[model samples]
Target: MMASSNAIEGRHGDASPPKASINACLPCRKVKMKCVIATHAMECNRCVRKSLDCTFREHRRGRKPGTRLSHKSGSSISRKGRGDMSTAARSSPRRDRVSDFWADSEGLQPDSLLSHQAMRGKFSLQNILSTDHGGNIDGVATSRSVPPDDPILLGLINQQVAMGLFEYFMEKLNPYISQLDPLLHTFPYAREKSSFLFTTILSAASKYFRSELYPVLHDHAEKLYAECFRRGEKSTEIVQAIMILTYWKEPNDTRAWTSIGLAIRIGMDLGWHKLRKSARDHGGLPDPEWREIRNVERTFLVLFVYDRSLTLQTGKPWMIERNEFIESVESWGEESMANSNDHLLCSFVALRLLTGDAFDLLTPHRKSPLPRLNRLLTILQNRIEGWRKKWLGAVGPGNCHVFLVQFYGAHLQLQLFSLPLQDTNIPDMDGVGDIMPFWVSYQNSMAMLELVTKYFHFLYLAQDSVHVMTAYAAIFLIKILLSAPSTIVREIETPTIQAISDATKAFVSQCAPPGSSCTLQARFLEKALRDYSSPRNHQSRPLVYNETDNQCHGKDGQVSVPDSRVEGRESSILSGLDLCDQTQDVPDLLFGDDGSWADLFASTGFNIQEGVFFS
Candidate 1:
């Protein structure tokens, strides 16, 4: 029988054999073309070219020539291509696709398979990308566990002066960034909890440390910062570190713009923006956890202030949107809290809110008619002054100096709009009028100059914001000199101008250490003064009308009196304006397109995302 079977197989092998190409992908088979693929695992050329899902299946052996199929087998074969999809899908494919969700398994018991199947119930794209567990968002802890071998940790521990630097930060710098509780964030607690935060604190107070150690500390902090993001770590410490670094930003540093933005975003991710009803309404003596919550709230408010500051400085759009919770923060000062610094924070936040309101109010209507825009400006000014009247005398002790800088800073910020809005020929504006009277900004500039020059101690521990404020005042004074009348120009004693110039130089000196880039608003101011004295750029026209007899003539032949506050000074830099320079034709420095004050600041390369100047 074996001989007979072998002889029969040999005879059949001689007949036409089955084609192996039947396993080729459908697209290639439809075209009756060769399906070329580098390997069996990949798509064939034709399907790849068409961007189609290439699939192949094993072909069953053709029926024997003498065999007859039963009716049931033939009916099943007919139903294979045409049947209810659900019923058809219930059956396994002839070929194993090896999909994780549906591929058949062998060793697993039914219970185990059910457990495996349940794992995907909560699957989501964000969960898969951002969370450590399948769908458990909180599965990933916020407190980053510092490894013993972490370079940041080791560096801090090895430095004998690390604790000393931390003390310097707590003593000198902590007041500026009062969100951190000194008692809670003790040296050991901070060092052990987050190396990034510890390194940042040391870096901020590095002026007291060895000057050479600043870079090393900063580099370590930055590395840990990037590592935190890489590991998807979320915590209050990281956000505060970013804010601190941004506030005490390096010279020519552009990183603060985007760094603050990222901090705000991560803050939202941590739900800092969400004030739960229970979190807000908790009563009686606060628990330790509640204090932690309040600290978080304080940080959030500080972040908002930082955001508004950026908008005012760089003309960038703010990231944190206004909401009811933020709107109510101005009232937080009235609330009794265990921490005294919070009262100061409340006042600061209130000031920032007013500044933000000014930005929002005027930014959109910049092109609107000056009358409508001025109405909005007047409203903002009223609100700001109301804030001043209410909060000025109420500032906590020792906080008055900082509050004054910001108060005058707000005045400067509001006046900045005048430089752009003063140009009546600005192609976009609907009508011509000045919302920010020329005298208003002029007085604010003198006030700012007087404050900075008088306090002088501000330069010792001043943040970048204070330095920028000084620059704004100096630049505003210098630029207005062109159209300023000889009377007003003479009144601005050479000593005052020299003093203002010296103040700017002091700022550059303070912020620019060994290799850092500090604010160059002073350089531009010098350039403007030199150009003003040059023979070619000496032409001047009546730029502003000074108040004579406590009144001035408007363009409509109507008499208007300047603000009474403008009268107190013995000499005013912008007290009068009508200087005439006939030596050469010069453009209007305050209003002309090329000479616009806005153009001067923009020339400093203030792109936030690129970190241009700050980098």
Candidate 2:
């Protein structure tokens, strides 16, 4: 019995301790801590120490044997397949070679085998902590403080090309945008300001330079923007870069409104909407402080301009409301002559504010009928004229930038007055008792064409707005030709229409680059003209005769008469009745129908007299 008891005791002592967990419990897995199970319990050491339940999750990591990488190049799994390969496997002589030429030369990490997906998703904690404060981890406050010779920062383009593009941007494009000052945004200043801004400068100038790096540079800019947006990064340079990209955007890009809206939001977040009162009060501030404050204000004004123009074009609501920030343009004190662009910018902002007023007056959202449209028209006209006179006098009419701004003012006034003519409800001036709107719109269309023809080369530089305005002018004229009453039609000679058409064609062909949105506008204008000039469309209209002599031929030698086929017995009955007294009232009769008079005339021409159109 003693031997048996001893044997039992030895067996109990020899039994192994409870096996520790091979897999981590859920809590341990989450925190990436090792799981140490108690000798005789299911709970892990970590869970027990924390007084929590320990549960294991069934998950198999890594890949199954003999499986190839995923076919999807964008998949994280595929990237891991390349990154997690054993060093021995990578050293095989027969394996595909990795391209690390740039990696070695640039002293970057050996990431040649990594996909763009990996690089985009890869973020260093240290780098984030550094850049989050708008500086490097090494204590640089801003990229501007970094040495301009940092090759990795300008890795996308050659150093020389970057310098050239920076110079070109300041010279050729900056005047139009007026965001960058040559004195402030020098080559070194731009190159070291921000990588995103540097890429944007190169991309904006690439088209004019005809550089082959446009596609690459433009793509890089987009990626950088996406990364910055994802990381919630904000800076003045980013705002300026966004504006540049929006101005010279990709063809058919739908992001213009959204992007400009984002820029405005970001700028507002940065407190760019308010002026620096402290800087304004203190005269002893450093030069850089004054420059920074000026840049902030300039950015806000430019953003306001972009927002207004884009909202008008897209028919979207205004992003920036009309506040004192935009309204204070006129009260600004005289700036030094060295920053003449400031005056031009201020004038441009004021003119756009006037445009904003015009937009507000005509907004479709208004529930009430337009109040005294004529009075409103006069007020807007005076404002636009005053603006033009002030700016033209300040900069002299010869300045190209000032001329462009003046042209925009003219375009706005044209749009305002022409609003009545475009209304479907009030088809003709007879309803409003205003022939001036019709004639003025016609004259503006003509003048706009002539002006564009004279200075298309200068205007083409601002292709964003110029192309749209030019197309609008040509199409508006075509609208008049096709539907205007005989009175106005007689005034528009054949030579004039032909001249405008030729100019439109030349502008589209010469100025519109391939793959430009202007090409689509040009095509639409061409189609409109083609459809109107077709003989079939004109043949459908009825013919009518001049009254008095009953046989007096009009200048065009085409008699006007109600179409018996369409009007049927109604025409015969009217002809049979005594219509001499009614002849004087024919103008009112032509517009008696609530439907469009242009539609009425196109379907059935009037035979009363030349007096109808004159009245």
Candidate 3:
């Protein structure tokens, strides 16, 4: 069988001879004549001969043709082109293109980014770039917490002392100030140090002033005044501080008053010379000018003197007698008259006389002996009108109008307080005719009211202390509302009152700790609101005595309802029976209850709680 098969193989081999060619590896694509397809793997004999790298997979038995071979290097090569190449090349270019498009569309240039970058580097850009979602990068930035030794804090301390809120502010700032020595001092005159001190003092002063901590404020102010005097550094700020302190203190001490007097004299002396020169150079107070700078100085002197007089009257251990102050004002008026300055003289006399007797005589029951408020109002109105006309051509009419408004409001307040509770009963003086004519000058009254309201609003808003401003504004609004006519009240809701309430609420919500200055105002407002709103005549009981009949009240001592419950009501019968009863006074019946009487009285002012009509 083997011999026969060898003879057959030899014959077939001769019939067809195989081609002689090198087998090539799939990866290298190189062929070699000595290449062995199976033992050398897929690599050609040439790659094997040259000792080059070959990443070809060995064919597996029964595997489908054209399938990817299993090899680590082949997998890596396939992933390289598909995964990383395009991405690596395209990322930077795409970002640059986007940035460029954004810049062009938004009108931003490359230079802006560069400039910003430069500035950022100088200022440490890391902080600027690290913004959270809130977009409040600098919102958390803190002011330099003033050191205890800082001059600014010292100034603030002095101001607080003046404003009477030192202890309160100190308590609030205790954590910070406690760490500092009382005598710790910063540089003598470094700008930052000075500014810091000044700002702190101003802030504290504003806070204390608003809080209405008057006692501590006055004490602090006096101390500061003395310190400034001792330092011999009487700059404008110091002088102003002293002036404000004097105003607030209304100092009764002879020495303190004398010092204030001296300060005033010094201010006057400095101011008078300048004013005289200005008048001389500018041609005698100029056209439409009613008062010169000298006049203003004199006005301040008069006001200060008047304030001192009031202090003497109201202050403890009153130094100056009321009669003596009145005499002095009379003399001042005479002097002003002698100088032919009727405006100043009139104003002086009017204020002095009005403030003394206006409150007592103007009320419903008290009789006034002084010039009737109507007369004063007339005089003021005429004067204001003249000034307005004269000054209109020169200065704007606004200032003149403002002056008129202030005078009007002041006079109105005085007059309102002076009026009898029943204004209708007070007959007009025969010669005066109807003073209502003057009072009815709606244009003037409205203008003045608007101006006064604005000023009050400004004060209320600008004040840092909620308690102080709220109290003051409340009082002011009360006074205004009380004096305002029913029509006026009906026409306008006080914006100042609303603002004060809102501001108080806000401040309380923000800065007021559990027990704080703001909380007091809040409580006050709440109480005021409640008190104002409670119903009048809440205590009055329905009259039922006359309605009790024997039939309704059975013999068995039990009450029975009638079949006609509506018509048989005993209360209605009693009301009719009591109507003509001469024994009862109508006024007594109406106002018998305290609630009714109190509500009647409360209607004169803003009763926040009741929301009643301001009569």
Best by TM-score: 1
Q: What is the clash count for each candidate, in the order shown?
A: 6, 6, 23
Model 1 RMSD vs true structure: 19.4
Residue 252: error of model 2 in Å? Answer: 1.7
For each candidate in the order shown, give its overall lDDT on alpha carbons.
Answer: 0.53, 0.53, 0.33
lDDT tens digits, residue span 142-253, model 3? 3444335333355533533433332333233311111111122122322233332333333344443444443443455455555555643322223334433332222122
* Residue 422 CA displacement from its true place in model 3, Å: 12
Ranking by TM-score: 1, 2, 3
Query: lDDT: which candidate is best?
Result: 2
Candidates 1 and 2, the one with greater lDDT: 2
- Candidate 2 lDDT over 358-452, as tens digits, reads 66665444433445766676677787888888877666345466657656776776676666655432234564437656666666766776666
Q: Which scores better on lDDT, 1 or 3?
A: 1
TM-score of 1: 0.62
Q: Which ten-residue region of model 3 has the weakest summed lDDT?
A: 174-183
lDDT of 2 at 422: 51
Regions of model 3 farther than 4 Å from truth: 1-223, 226-238, 245-279, 282-373, 384-457, 460-529, 535-615
| Evaluation by TM-score, superior candidate among 1 and 3 | 1
